[model samples]
Target: MTTKSITIKSDRTIKSIMPPTKGEILCKVSGHPKLFLRVNASGAKLWLYRYTHPVMKSKHKLSLGSYPAVTLAHATAMRLEYEQLLQQGIDPKAHREQQIKDEHKSLASTFEKVAWHHFEQLKNKQKATTLKRKHGRYELLCSYLGDTPIGDIEPLQMLEVLRDIQANSLKDDGTPTDKADRCAVIASDIFNHAIVHGYATNDPARIVKPMLDSYRYGNRPSITTPSEFGQLMRDVETLKGTVHDSVFHSIKLLSLLFIRNGDLRRLRWSDVNLDMAQIDLQPMKGHGASKLRMVKDMIVPLSRQAVEILKAQQAITGHTDYVFHSDTATKNNIINENAANDALKSLGYQGTHCAHGFRASARTMLRHKLKYDKDVIEMALGHITRDPNGTAYDRWEFVEERSQMMQEWSDYIDNLKTGKTDNVIKMPRMRQNDIKTV
Candidate 1:
């Protein structure tokens, strides 16, 4: 005799059903036609959805879940979803497998993983100091979004993370808006990398600018006037007690060269051509594509005074590759970037003067006091300026004129140091014909 099949009404009804003597028993759920509760001879109950693919025309069985774990209501809902997929001519089993694979991919392609890849690309392109700062920013990003899937990040979520960074990352003055701005930029770059590598679809950090506080551009504190700068020089000359001779010379060269602190710290003996009276420099700033793309070899004409400073330094660090080798073995081989600024602080010029401020001091005095060609002055400071015709001026152009200008500038500084204020050299006038019309 054949037994009739029972329709499953609820959980208790499912529990009361008896297993088949030989194999398994299939009980149909009342509202879900394709959904069934299968009970094996050992009473192991499971939910299954059986259907035929409209396109493939083949019977397929998809396991919704085990019984009790997946209640009758959940199994019904899952069956309905699979039935909809079949109606749309999609293979439900294949679709479910693809979903599992996508989830695994998302777990592996996390924000921190992509960020490290992006940082590796910058190691050779960016300066050491800049790389250090960017690494700190990356750590901050990882703290909040490290494990999150890059593709799953949303704009609002990015804004929330950035806002937290802004609010928490405070200096003595207050929150550093620049930190927030920089973090946002770094996050955007990571997302851009993710998109290129197929790990993400959109850059959520791109649109987060409007959510951050505005940052004001402030000039570095500097002694702009010649009188104050002269006093600063005299103070530097008389710097006494505990200051290393190498550091003192580094300060003097920084004053004369006005190069970035990073470039100054990384200076090498090979970069200086004392016999030729020129210093070949590769500035740390403006060397990358994002900032200015002005990364090229720069030539600085050395003054007799500047050349003498290098000659004296040779007595100490000439044996080493770096011009400013560190005294301690635990530290970097070269002088730390903050050594010059710290020396200034020792001389009571902490907030008023900095190592980088020398650039400003030279730029201002070169324009107002020395009366040098603006273009030549800028080139002397390793700045990239353009001609009136919109063409970038060659970095090595006007080498002769710049050499003379450097010599005269050194002489002017000498006069200031000797307190011979009255013996100012009359700057040669630029010929009217030599001046280009804008």
Candidate 2:
């Protein structure tokens, strides 16, 4: 092929080589024998590197980029590198293609991309609240490490990001924070997912997790003694004004049933059955807040006093969907989770007792004061109790025993409030019978 030998040394000289008036033209560089500048009739300029394969001796042209975008010096540098590859028995064209494929793969397996994939996989498995929190955590992680390739993230880099989160968490309270540790847990899960999917070779987050400040799970405040609990019950009953009707009934039920605060607040009219004297529903821990949700329903037998409180609550919020409907809430009809806690705080039970404390109180009192069995109380508390043979307790396994225990518990509460311990019922311990498997 015939070509024009162009003495292109600088941008000015390269720019001076204008498009051909008739068709595209290939102007050969004077010094660089393998490099040529191709100019088209449409005024488009391109740099091309022509080389011969080492084994086959076949000639091929590779693009070095455009004229203005890729300067003459850059083009010469790329030509030299390509010639070195050819000398090493490597085809420059194939090597360039492989590099491009690797670049695309790196972009696709970034931490942000892999984390989003993992988050999407949990959409159906998690509840709305859980999904929302996870999405927030993902966004936080992306803000720091999004552009980084998953496999490229090192343990030290992951630790730095976690420390930043922990540091930011202290801005409000100035106290030691567990945010970093929590974020580390999330990152570990994401890294583990990436490893399983082949996006990453190792979990740097897992390696860095042990380096972070250890987080401890603290239980909510509760009163376990009989006299103190009875005084708290009296205070709740006698407390007047400013409390919403829903909050009042909620506290009463929370004390009597000793179920989770979330379960009590989210109670619906459909879940409660006054005729059956039972509240047959799933606990809230298994729904959104918990990592592992209990699939089976929790059956809460209603005592005479609990049934009385429900009948009273029914007359007030019967029209609304929730049993404890919040009048001030705009987003949901249910009462705020803190409403009862705030009310108890007002009644001088700030750190001494909380809405959730009633569960611990009932568990303790039933076991010590009322002389009830551990499994029966645990079942009533919505806990997972197992038999001696390692079998999980069925939903209705201790229903009968729990029913009697609940009635006695309510009566015991009444006796405590009225200072009538002598009136407490002395009943024989109910024997476990008709054991069934789930």
Candidate 3:
């Protein structure tokens, strides 16, 4: 009996047999030595063929590929070509795999893609700042090395970033932390995550170590001496208005608050009790927890100067709840951490001060000049210092004292802004407690 050829569309319907099912058709394609048609559940059909290596007698199969894409005529032609190759002792499958590998060679995989995917997989599994930090690293990686394929990134490329960060070495400030060893670990984690998902062949980051005894850490901008700090404050006082005076007195006041620039930027009227003259700082994520016992419900008795600055800021940007808003009607927060630094730089106060430097400036002045106890000053600045008594105690025990401390602190900062004498202001008596205690 002659075997009937399978029609591309005909289902063996005329006889008692039902239309050929997908499994039957698929099996036929896999088993056929010459030619066969397979139909899928979606009614899609394609042609496939089977061949034996003439030299090795090894059986193998070849797909003519998808229909319409591989026209019947082209498939027939390809089948004849494969037979010719088999006759010539060439393995068709090996050639196709090689072609596949070559087609992907010119493409480069980026760390950014891996970083983004890493974050996506880790979302809500960690702190929000982790997301933000990873995102920033993603941008830098993309900007700097996104064009490189995942498998091609080398240890040298990563070490160079580390060296650049250690150099503070970038602008005058040296290598930013993005190039730090810790940051390198994060970069490795991103590549490792890709390896987990099969996107990366290996993590180049793993070649770098946790800590190198001799490798210089990232360049950290430090105050180092009180005199240089004083020079910085004196220089800051000279900052004047730009075009619309985008740099205002409030931004200067914010520099003294010295919380994360973003937290200060988002400071809202709801977060502040002006009648009580206190700023209620909600503990921001990523910055270590505020250790002041006064925090949570802590009342930052606004200094006369801080209050004045707030009031002045209120009058101008009252349209929103933020005391110091940006020009773009964004939230009341200051947009640029760089704004304070830039303002300082424009005034010839180069690397000596950063917005964060204000915290150091205040802490140092409180210690040396105002004579506020270390804990009180640290608490006021949202820092938690170990109690010398060897136990965790209220860092800001004297609210009245702290209120006085903060007031003095504010006045001193205002003095610096106004070009007043360079003398460090004295802190007021640490208040024991006046009110707002539960």
Candidate 4:
């Protein structure tokens, strides 16, 4: 017996169709050529479109959607769209697949997603503090272009975000121009990362550089003159009023050690070897021009003055692991990061002298005044200076020279502090012919 094909009339008629005994049955829809209601053995009614590819001249089946979910009227509209694509010499199946692929590509290329991928690459290589700062800048960028595709963001969009940061981020006196510049730099790095990884084609942030405020170049505020530095040392020795004694000692050690503020604050008693007269500092990751590969502990040859200060500090904070232990509850029980600087400000050295100025002071005097080797002084400052042959100095290079220099430096500062050094080095006077008369 032959089964007759019935035209689907309404939603009720479509739902009333019985499943075939073994396979699926396709009931044709009236007034629609290729559209039909498919009733499967499992009792699911679906819409199918039977078509011939214009290019291949072969038949193809396309599932529009399940029936009831996609009504007869909706299936008719879809069939019309497929017919339009056929008339344009396109395969409906290939077109739909291309659309899905494009959508996935777009999602993967979004600014937020791509930036996060770039950050993951950096999180392993950078220090924890450096990563924290970068994460903060990334969050700000995401606030503006989180959902935007990385390739779609233009240079103007990046500039707008930077302008907003420049205007909104305030310091005590004015806008933080340095922070705005940093944001631009970080955005450029992210875009570069995206370009390398195929998430973007161009760096929008690179073009925004000319639009940012020009950074003013000047020396870091420091008491480089010997007499001023000597007086600053004396003031630090007798520092009183409003500054905690622990903070005072921290500032003293900072001047004597001339290490970075973070390094000093995070100094552990375990890292100090008074008998060896050395500080085996771990590789500190932050802003610096040193090209030394951080493969091992940084050796800081301690001066007798530095060792004595540590011995005294051991009398107070020796029980704790950190040399600069915090009195109150806090993370790591280390002293506050700004304690040394705040003590400097309280000593009336706010703009003229800073905690970092100690490095500058030691670097200048050790090089010019005391006539120490430049490479040894740079090594003492933890900077990677190149040798005469243009090779980068190793971390442990000039160990004995640095040790002697550290001793002489401490003794020189002692002479200056006690006003016993009358042989202060003077800047060479310019000759009459060498001076340009305006």
Candidate 5:
């Protein structure tokens, strides 16, 4: 190999230089010591930075990059940077390797990767429905900021994501939905998990909560009056033998039981006891991030009407695990979450009554008209109403009273649908003296 001093003034000048006939040659760049343009016999040109190791005091060469890609100006700039590192007793090659290592680590610690890791840890801790919702929210955030490192995320960036969600994500009622707030909560949980595992230093989501719009609760639209509810019952009767036959049965059962939509949709045949006339459902009340935490499965006292609906439904789906099984469903074989709601919409009840509206209707009529015990009504609705000691009442505590209440409620609904005047006579409130002394 031969070395010569050459001035590479411009891009054209560098291209004009020719390679050696048999061996490689080095042309020193003007005004930058130890920086050489290496030309090979195969016509390949590369930039090399020859320097002494700051600690070892031995000469070494580092490939700056190739020519054309690494221009004359750029190669000299790298040579200057390496000289500064050598002055501070640092090896430029080792420094570059450390930076590469940090880049790889940052890629591995992205917000999306950290969030999924957190979810994996929660498999046994959270309920399936809650976990599914959390994952969906995480995905919304991941779509926007998945590539960002969790440790590098700022509060303002998180706020911007939340603002976008709040602005675009709307409900059928044309109102801002709670999806943004829920997403913020999930992001905070992910950051907290990342912090625990050393992937993040702080929770940007936690810092930005006050900056986002507060979610407002709205009552689901429902037919509150007896006449309107009776008409709904009649309208549902007209939907039998249609494509929504399963939803028709589900709607009828919703009216009779008034359970949460998720609980009813995910209801399993194994949970229904036809002989006992009750449904032992593991309610999704106290799952991940839910305020109302529950430790026991809710026991719903099935009314005669509800039992009849279940029996009819059992004949069609007894071979499947889910009572609302659908062969075309993508996830679980059960029906879609909005199946009953869509069915209600098709019945011209859109914006008036929904599948979830059944619960509110039942609560109002059962309280004002039926006059059932408040505790029994609440418990039957799968609400966790605690006693005086702060401990929740046992699911079976009000079973007998709820059974009577449920039977009465079902009979009243039947009376309404048939246009009968069988108003329930208010049961006399029992006093302490009414109880027989032992």
Candidate 6:
């Protein structure tokens, strides 16, 4: 006989048996949905369930996992939920697991993860410092909006963040404050990354514009000219007792060779061909050991001055593969990230120039002053070739051509500093051949 409510004596022990016998089949529970109580034949205390399946015609047995683990209130709610599912003809177990899976799917697509995924895609395509800066942006996003799920960063919240940045950051024209228009571009990219990877439905940043009613005041500064750039290099040469001298020289070499500073500073001696004045750029940054890390190698030809600098550095440094190094205790180790900038400041030319300002200088000098082919400059810089049809073309960085370029460059710097620079040289069309005497 089955009854909904019954109680075992407080002193008596109860047991559930595979086959019932009169002496052993006692009142199984203490009749309270709030508390489940039973005892097995070995006198083990157990919890029992007395409920009907919401979706099945037959009553099935399920262990409520384990005792103490399945607390009374939790068990009661679970039982009631199953009963409701049964009433609705839904499989409660399958449905619950599916619900958990769905919840996980929602949480997996956070803004931080998606933005990082975008950064990961572009990591190798960019320079090392560029990668570091992008990673920095990701860190900022994590700090400010990381906890907010990807789908939840509405346009208004993004707008607020942009406005706040403008309010506190320094402004041009001596204004009290201004929003970071450049940072707004960064935010747009983060949202774009989310959209590209399906982490977000739309780029919220794209929806908002950083204009004071259509007067788009983007604040990217104009770069220094190659002539002005020459003086900076002279200053770098004259810079005394600065820790950054080594980094500054390396940065100068990068501008002359037109290479990424990250790639240039991280070079090893084994990659250089002093005999041929060439550098067999590895398929990745730092070559040998770091290629396995998925960085692509690029070959760059060393200029005459570049080779001279290396030889000078080697005279003092002794036998080592690193072309650029520091006075740190670690053997075979190079300078840290801040070494170049520190050197720049110590040389008394801070704020007026940058290690990367060389890129702007080179791009302009090659394009206007020397009037070399754009593709040639790009190739020299180890930038991605514009020739879409070209296979991984390994052009031996034409040493003779670069040698002429280097001599003229060095001479131009000397002339600029001595106040003998020609007025006509500033004209955009001035060619390399036109300046016969340096």
> Per model, how many backbone clashes are there?
0, 0, 14, 0, 0, 14
Q: What are the lDDT scores of the predictions, listed in order?
A: 0.81, 0.82, 0.59, 0.78, 0.83, 0.57
TM-score of predicted model 3?
A: 0.57
Better of 3 and 6 by lDDT: 3
Clash count, predicted structure 3: 14
Which stretch of 10 consecutive residues in model 3 shows the poorest summed lDDT?
A: 9-18
CA displacement after TM-score superposition, residue 297 of candidate 3 (Å): 8.3
Using lDDT as the measure, which candidate wins? Answer: 5
Compose the digit string of candidate 5's lDDT tens values, residues 136-183.
887889999899988999988999999999999887777787888888
RMSD of each: 4.9, 6.4, 12.0, 8.4, 5.7, 10.5
TM-score of 2: 0.66
Off by over 4 Å in 4: 1-81, 87-136, 139-147, 151-219, 238-246, 282-288, 292-299, 325-333, 384-404, 418-438
**Model 1 weakest 10-residue run by lDDT:** 429-438
Shift of residue 332 alpha carbon in model 1, Å? 10
For candidate 6, write residues 157-232 as lDDT tens digits: 8777666655656446544342355555666787777766666787666676544222233322224574566566
How do these models rank on TM-score, best leading? 1, 5, 2, 4, 3, 6
User: Whole-model lDDT for model 5 versus the true structure?
Assistant: 0.83
Question: What is the C-alpha lDDT profile of model 1 across 94-213, one tens digit per residue?
Answer: 999999999988887899999999999998787677899899999999999999999999999999999888888666677465788889999999999999999999988889866798
**TM-score winner, 2 or 5:** 5
Candidate 1 vs 6: which has more TM-score:
1
Best by TM-score: 1
